[model samples]
Target: MKFKNRRAMLWHFLKGNKRFFVLSILFSGLVSLLDLINPKIIGFTVDSVIGTEETALSPYLESLILQIGGLPYLKQHIFSIALVVLFVAFLAALCRFLFRLFNSMAAEKLIKRMRDLLYEHIIYLPFSWHNQNQTGDIIQRCTSDVEVIKNFFAEHLTNLLRVVLLIVLAVYFMSGIHVGLTVLSAAFIPVIVGYSFLFHHRIGESFRKVDIMEGQLSAVAQENLTGVRVVRAFGREAYEKDRFEEMNQKYMNTWIHLMKLLSAFWASGDLIGGLQVMLVVAVGAVLTIRGAITTGEYIAFVSYNAMLTWPVRMLGRVISEMSKAGISIDRIAYILNSPVEEDPEEPVNAPLDQDICFDHVSFSYGGESPEVLKDISFTIKAGSTVGILGGTGSGKSTLMYLLDRLYNIEPDEGKITIGGVDIAQMDRRYLREHIGMVLQEPYLFSGTVADNIAITQESTEMAEVRAAAKIAALDEAIGKFGKGYETYVGERGVTLSGGQKQRVAIAQMLIRKPEIMIFDDSLSAVDAETDAKIRKALGERTDQATVILIAHRITTLMKADNIIVLDHGRIAESGTHEELLSRNGFYRRIYDLQSPEEA
Candidate 1:
């Protein structure tokens, strides 16, 4: 789950696509080598053809010149020399093109792999981890941070390699012309490199601050967009706008500070580079006048030194940009390093169609927090209906989450079981597949009504979808829409009323045909008539499945075979409706509150 460092993590991600980057580096080396040849040819032409200096080309090149009819033939046909220069230029351009192409291919593949892995890892992460992290912040890590890493490899890292190689080779070529001039030129490199390292160290913390501010800005925007409806309903649009603007301004200020630092670094580099150029030019002129180096050799040496100009400047830029990559990599690693939900070591697909037991189960959301559910014990017999009544914060939903294994209870706290088999030992995927829960605030994906209902199935079957909708008492509502079952539900089912969304969710679960179904206050949004109708339909269809209903409504739980009332974190009463009413306990108190007119 955790990587030792950035390099180890990068190597892990580079698994399938390293070959493409290898090819890119190879082509880039070819391009750098090819680029060195043109200056040599230009120098050779100037010295031999025009000035009558001895041909100083290497033996292999001299042999090629002989094949092309010797120095006298070249002097008469000087254009042939131009043709050779142009040929080298064309090959350099071709290699440059291939280098970029392969580099681009590698970058795209690397980003795709990163995205796929992040998405997969996120989905499998525990619910507790999700609760502890913010949605917008996580999104920023996945998107913006991932992009920074892509640029790191494709642009900065590769550029670093290419520039370093070019500088070394250029210096070597310059040394061949005049070792003294080469020494002077190479001396400036250490200064530039040392300055770049200093700048890199200083700017890294600045980039980190900027990146953190950007994530905060992204979170603010995401929060506003998601809760736009709440802002509109409360007439707080102006307040929300001000809030976003404040965050945006902070983000902008941080970025401006970073840019200012970068500008200073670049401007200083240019000044140093210019001074180096002046020294090289002044010294080379003296050497040429003294006849220590010929005019052609002086020009070629200058050309090679000129090549170092961009690469030297770029070396600083690349190193500074590389600092941003470290920040991004750590951000991504935070997500990847978080442990994912793992199955039990020896998991079993236990039969869930049996008595569901919560045995001495106690839970706290955090270690130091008060227990949400304390010493809780209950049972739902196989193929029977049960109801739970609780007030807000009575840990009603928490109980269902525990049964679903969304939050595992510590071994010392307690255990839950179905068919006398501990739920902890069951395969998570298999357990969840057999237990269908419809939550209070139903979330429907952006899809047709039929699609939402049939989401559990691989392929949508209209017949099954319609049947599920009928049981949830949603068929008539679907018929009212022009598109009926095909009607598009907007984001989070915003297009549907609260009751309608609940019905859709109920229908979605019904289509799955799970052995155990829990309705976690799901019917509270619907009217009593619709609620009664849904209960009747469920009674007729779900004869063989275990049902556990949690609700605040007395009428909702009145018809259950057994009802348990949770007060605070413990059970206050447990009995049938008639028996509980006769006892005048917690269930009786709730019934009286709801049916006051009857009372």
Candidate 2:
């Protein structure tokens, strides 16, 4: 995944468009050559036809003119010479158009390829990478950094080649007129290029600083928008506004400073280029007066000098802008270089049946963090219902995460098996598809209620969706809305209450009819009456599937066939509700606290 240089990395994405890019450059060279010919043609017409002397022409060109009746025919039809100039101009314009067209094709294709790769890579990255990286920062790199690279190829890189060609061709033609003046005009090129290189090298760190600041500003805006409800509930609107304004001002200041530096570089380049032009014009005038070069030759020499001036000047700016592209490329490279989660080469397709076992499994969040689940062991029999009861930070959710293989455990630590086959050997996708989990805080995409419920199934039946809604006790509440199942749930289901959102999530999972269904404190937001109804409804439908329920309510777990009570990342008790009550352990204590009358 390591690239030898930024160019190599960019080329990895752009190589597919190599033919088009090469053609663009070739057309650009042709355009430069045609442009150079116009000035020479003008000089020839001025000397041979308009001036007091006849200019020497190439033998072939001279013979062609003689065949056309020599100077007499040309003098009578002076517009013929004008027609020649128009033809050369027309060819140059055509070449310029072709160059631009091909360059655009190459640039757009490269952009599309790069964006597709980045998006695909990001989604496949391990869950831990997403947790460690800020969402806004990653978004900035994908958008702004990608744009910088696109401009580098479309404008800076192509312009660099075109400018270099112009300079080479201009100097070559000027040398034919007077070697001394060509050298004098070309001397400023090195000075301008070297100064620009040094300036760009120093400016890179500043650009990076500005880029980082912009990411921070974007993150602030993203966070504020996502948590607008929380901010309003706490009456922190003023505080949020002040925080955003401060960051925005800082971002603006950094960009202002960078722009100032760029302006300074441009002004300095203009000064040097202006002086070089003056030197060329003055020296050519002296040479013409002394008869060292013809009047026509001097005019053409000045024309070539003017042609070279802007490109050499622009060459410096292009190089400087190219330096900015390097920074952007490095930023994008960081994402591309990160390794994605690897799936087994030859995965075992184990049927999700039989017992699920956690054989002395131990896990931490990695590094020096304390273990979240320590030496845990349990088993849920096939087609049985198991309830897990625990307080906050009791490793209840962590255990389920391991079962689903969202995070893998080290081989030496322990292992989980489904149907007596090590889950690690199974394909992650296949394993997850069979295990349906409704998270504690469920997230719903912006869609209609029916759309959210049927999201797991490609082709959804309204009858089946309504049945799942009834089992989760969400049918009546949805019916109350004007649009019913078609109601649009805004971002993250913000339009729904906490309990309604949780029930919608339950309906979503129930639609899949997974082999193993897990409810991770999913009913906590609903009232006790609604909770009892949901549990009763689910009990009837999920008899054939293995079910694991994680709940804090005593009433919710007391009906379970077996129960395990967790305390501080360890199992404190395990038995049926009656057996646990007899022991008077953590389970009994929790049951008493939730149901004082029953206790």
Please give, for residues 435-473, the per-residue lDDT of candidate 1 as tens digits.
999987888889888988898899867998999999999
lDDT of 2 by residue, 360-419 (tens): 998888768798888888899988889999999999999998999888888988899888
Misplaced by over 4 Å in model 2 are 1-8, 229-248, 492-494, 596-599
Instruction: Quote the positional error of residue 492 for candidate 1 in Å.
Output: 9.4
lDDT of model 1, residue 166: 92
lDDT of 1 at 185: 90
Angstrom error at residue 507, model 2:
1.4
